[model samples]
Target: MSLLAQLNAPFMYLLCGGIILFVALVCVFFMIRAYRAGKAMGIDTTKMKRVITASATFTLLPSIGILLGVIALSGSLGTPWPWLRLSVIGALHYETQVAEAAAEAVGLQSLSASLMTPTAFSTICLLMSVCIMWGMVFSVFFNKRYLRRLGAGSKSGKPGGGFGDRAMTAMFIGLICAYMGSYIGGFVSGNGLFRCAGSWIPLGVVAVACLSMAGFMWLYEKKNAVWVESFSIAGSMILAMAAAVGLSALA
Candidate 1:
């Protein structure tokens, strides 16, 4: 059997599902433990429930999007790698780029199930894992200190507050610019990168998402609807996905 076929074998799914189940159990254990701790400390259980509801509602959309990403990558890389990466420290935005970079480094233009060999698959997996490990290592060692410093600065409410806000804004802007620039460059270069009709779908999706979010924001301001703010992200995601489908069909 081919490497891709092996990767998609039943054993891989069982292994992936086992790891994911263990992680989920660990997460639930900690959550329940924390809830018990709060109860012992006489924290209001009612307020805690409310907080949990709001947090879960906010997180649901993004988690769905991440699952969609895992599905997308699974078609090419199989289920185990994407499932493991995304279930842990992996960000949705970084997975494709990491795969693409790893593939390029191995003298492949891109990775696909049909074209991949065992050696190439293993190399890409190792490279992507190692590349992300630096961030995980730093977080393990320095995350507490980083949060402490941030808290101290916020309390000061001077250069700390302003600088923190600006820094975060700049960071997000930089990330968006980098993603957008890469797509724009690919389209402009047209070196077979944009040759496929489906290549334009991502651009359409982005535009649709942005426009939907902006429209929701405007409506929120005018109508003073509290739910609009909550649903904005979800609405944009759904509309963007629909737009992608429509655009792909048209193309």
Candidate 2:
């Protein structure tokens, strides 16, 4: 059978659907447990219900981006896998990067459905599933210790009090720089996915995204637009994607 056919097969859908259902059950179980625990702690049931309602309402906005991610990935990787991944532990950026890397490792230029094969698809699925688990595995063993250390540092009021926050910020900055460096390199060397004059598209899209995010943050901080916080990331992503499409057309 064809790669897309295999990807979207009945069994694939069944497997993904089963996994998502299991996750939903686990979430519901935790929700009930938490609700009971809150009552035992003397928290009012009405307040707890309000908190739950607010949490679910806030989740809807971020979920739109996840839904968009699934749509973006579904064109090449198929619907079931993307749906399962994003519904579970996967982020849009991480999934796209890993999938593209896996496809390239298997001699595919991109994650395009037309360029994909069964082997390439398997490679992507394996890599995406396995490679992203290291953080969770480490957390399973060390998260408590890490939290204790972080708490101690905070209590001490020393220069190291902010170490955890600083470390996380540095890591995030490093990741952004890595991606930006690749885009700049591609722009300069003309060695990116688009070797033509369009090699700068990635950089351009990133710039647009950054600007959009900055505008949203300004609105939130300066204008006191409280609702902008939830939409900032999703709004920037949508704008960046639109910019990419426009640039691609121009190219």
Candidate 3:
């Protein structure tokens, strides 16, 4: 059978649908419980409604991005696994990295329908599952202890009271720098997936995104545009994606 046929088989779609339905049910259950708890705690109904509305509004863009990731991975891993994995434990980009690493472990350059076999695909799924499971297990069993060890100030009820927040900020900055460095390296080596007009598309996308974000910030400050404050990141991301496509067309 063709890889596409296999990945998008009827059984796969059914499995994906079932898993998504289960997740939805679980979410609904928790949401109901939380609603009841809020009422029990005498939280104002109007405030709760506003909170929910704002939260959902903020989630719209990120949820769309997650859906895009699912679509992207579905082409390679199929609907069931990507849906299951992303619906559970794993960020969109992290899952893709894990999938690629899993593929590489089995001697594959990249996951393609033509190149993937059942066994290879299973291996990739298993590796990805194990990696996520390990993190989940650690978080479930030892995260609190680890935080305590880091002097997070849990006992004082003022968690991360001192340098912990600063350390975390530093760590996040370092992670961002590492990812940016990799992008730079890819640009320099001409080794990125998308190349446009003799340059990596990612670099151009990043440049466009950074400039867009700066513009948004300027508008938010100088023009005092309140609407742009909440949408700056999503706006920049969308513009970057558009820039990428435009650059690709030029190439």
> How does residue 78 of candidate 3 score in lDDT?
78
Candidate 2: regions farther than 4 A off: 148-251
The predicted structure with the larger lDDT, 1 or 2, is 2
Residue-level lDDT of model 1, residues 38-128, one tens digit each, is 9997889986775676577668877988999899989889988898879876889899889988888988877788777788888998888
- Best of the two (2, 3) by TM-score: 3
Q: Rank by lDDT, descending?
A: 2, 1, 3
Give the alpha carbon lDDT tens digit for every residue of 1-251 in model 3: 78777878889878767877887899899988988889997889777776666566667767888988888888888777887788877788799888988888988889766778889998998898788787878889998989888766366755455777888899999998998877777776655344522367778888999999999999999999967766777788888888989999986
Report the error of model 3 at residue 116, Å: 7.3
User: Best candidate, lDDT-wise?
Assistant: 2
**Each candidate's TM vs. the true structure?**
0.64, 0.61, 0.67
| Model 1 score (lDDT) | 0.81
Worst 10 residues of 1 by lDDT: 152-161
lDDT per prediction?
Answer: 0.81, 0.85, 0.81
